[model samples]
Target: MTYPKRFAALPEYAFPRLRSLLDHHDPGGDVVHMTIGEPKHAFPSWVGDVLAENTAGFANYPPNDGSPELLGAISDWIKRRYDVGLDLNQIMALNGTREGLFNAAVALCPEETARGERPVVLIPNPFYQVYAVATATVGAEAVFVPATAETGHLPDFASLPPQILNRAEICYMCSPANPQGAVADRDYWAKLIALAEKYDFRIFADECYSEIYRDTPPPGALEVAQEGGADPERVVLFNSLSKRSNLPGLRSGFVAGGPETIRHIRQLRAYAGAPLPLPLQRVAEKVWADEAHVEENRALYREKYKVADEVFAGIDGYMPPDAGFFLWLPVEDGEAAALKLWTETGVRVLPGAYLSRDTDRGNPGKQYIRVAMVAPKQEMRDGLTRLRDCIYA
Candidate 1:
């Protein structure tokens, strides 16, 4: 039997590959899990009450696009957070940003761009796996740009060859980027939006980690686009309650952008997607309308950031991320460091290489390890102390 070849060449998913590497080893001490970025913070107290109140809605089929209340909440949140206006038709509730991130490619990417080519989708080298899969799903060229320490942990899309940029259809950028914790500033978003307008491509900005920052909130792509007078049709922003409200299990998120782009996405989704249940949509509306819980959650991440800073201070090549909750620590070889740490200290972590791909120059993540600061404050500190001593010492 023949199978689709598009995914046949993809690298193994990171976690399974990690299990293959260290599953057999027994830790010498209490096992501390610093691998996945699952939040350890408490969710809003009202979530339960809202879910209970709306339990009756679960008896019937839910709206696919989103309930009017939920859509209004999303629109209100966008206006409050980014000062960007989005009509109900311009926003569609997502199962999660992961779904939006992948499905947007299928909906937005053209078979051919201005250059009359298969079009290239610009992806960061150590990027979220979904981006590349989305690019390949559309039968476009997946061009991996290096987001290395040298580049402030963000890809320089402007550096690409003019020919590639001209044919570019979509570029996936993550702010307070996953694994790296690098936030895109106003200038970064402005420049990328300009490039997207100049080349006639769309910007898929993953702002899921937008609420988990240290000091000031990270600037968003849509905000910059509006300020710069770029076409609203040129950008789509994805946000989630996962990191923001500590509700990854809720699978609640939204995609907001130009009316036409979102209309296309909603049209495609109606045929292939299961919308958030009415009950869950009620919970989401309340979640977005309230900001107190989000502020409390951000404070928790801030505490963890302080712990990371204190633990790794004076250590060479240790940089505390500006935002997000992952530490991309430098090492000789990520896999070797992870193995040594697990066997010696019983702390588990993910190799940076697993998060990235090898390019013509090199795998930028090959020399680092990704430590998620998602454990509790005490456990986070303990894990970092153990990791620092075992891996860096």
Candidate 2:
């Protein structure tokens, strides 16, 4: 049997690779998982009530794009959060932002540049794996740009050559980034928007971790785009209730952009999409409208942030994340540190190199490990203490 070679270059996903690396080894101590970013917080107490009320709707097929109620709720949230008014047509409900992130490229990335060249898709190194898979699936040249400590953990897309920028169709960026927790400020968004406008490309802003910040809410790409008066189609924003509402299993998210861009996404989704069950859509509608639970959730993460800072304090190269839950701690070698921690301390972490691709300068994540703070406060503290003593000591 033959398989498509499009994905031939991709490595086994981060978790599977991790299992292969450590599952066979006997853990040296009590196990404390600090790997995956899956949030362990309690979701709103009313989710079950809402699901019960809407259970009957499950018998019916959900709207392909989204129920009118769900879309309206998402639009209202966007307006409240970003201060940008958007018609319901400008948004499409997604199973999760991950699904939308991958499919948006299929729906919107042009087959070829206007100059008849294969388009380039810019991705930040140490990126969410979906970006590279999406780029390769679309047959675009995937240009991995470094987002190391030197660059403040955000990719400097403007530094690329004019030739690469000219053929660029999309760039994937995560603010309150996954492993590094760097948030893009207004100036960063403004410059990126200007670059996109000058080069005729779209920006896929993955804001899944946008709600888990420590202090002032991180500025959003959509809000910044509106301020700059850039083409709405040029900035496609993807967000989710996973981090915001502590409802990762709820699998609720949305993609919002200009009407034309959404039209294409909706068209592709109509054929290939699995609409959230009507019951789940009803649950999402209510979830988007409620911020009390979200605020409570953010407060918990804020407390955890303090715990992390206190734990890693006085450790060199320890940068407390500006926002988001992960701590990208510097190490001599990510894989080696992770293996040592797992075997000696039984506190599992993901090697930074697993999240990044190798390039000429070397993989930016090669010398670090990503530690998620989603466990309960005391448990997280205990794990971090063990990790610090076992590795940093």
Q: What is the C-alpha lDDT profile of model 1 across 140-189, one tens digit per residue?
A: 99999999888999999999999899888899999988889999999888
Best by the TM-score measure? 2
lDDT of 2 by residue, 135-201 (tens): 9899999999999889999999999999999999999999989889999999999999999999999
- Best candidate per lDDT, number? 2
- Cand. 1 Cα-lDDT: 0.91
Model 2's alpha-carbon lDDT is 0.94
With a 3 Å backbone cut-off (N, CA, C), the pairs that clash in candidate 1 are none
Residue 370, model 1: lDDT of 95
Candidate 2 residue pairs in clash (backbone atoms < 3 Å): none
TM-score of each: 0.99, 0.99
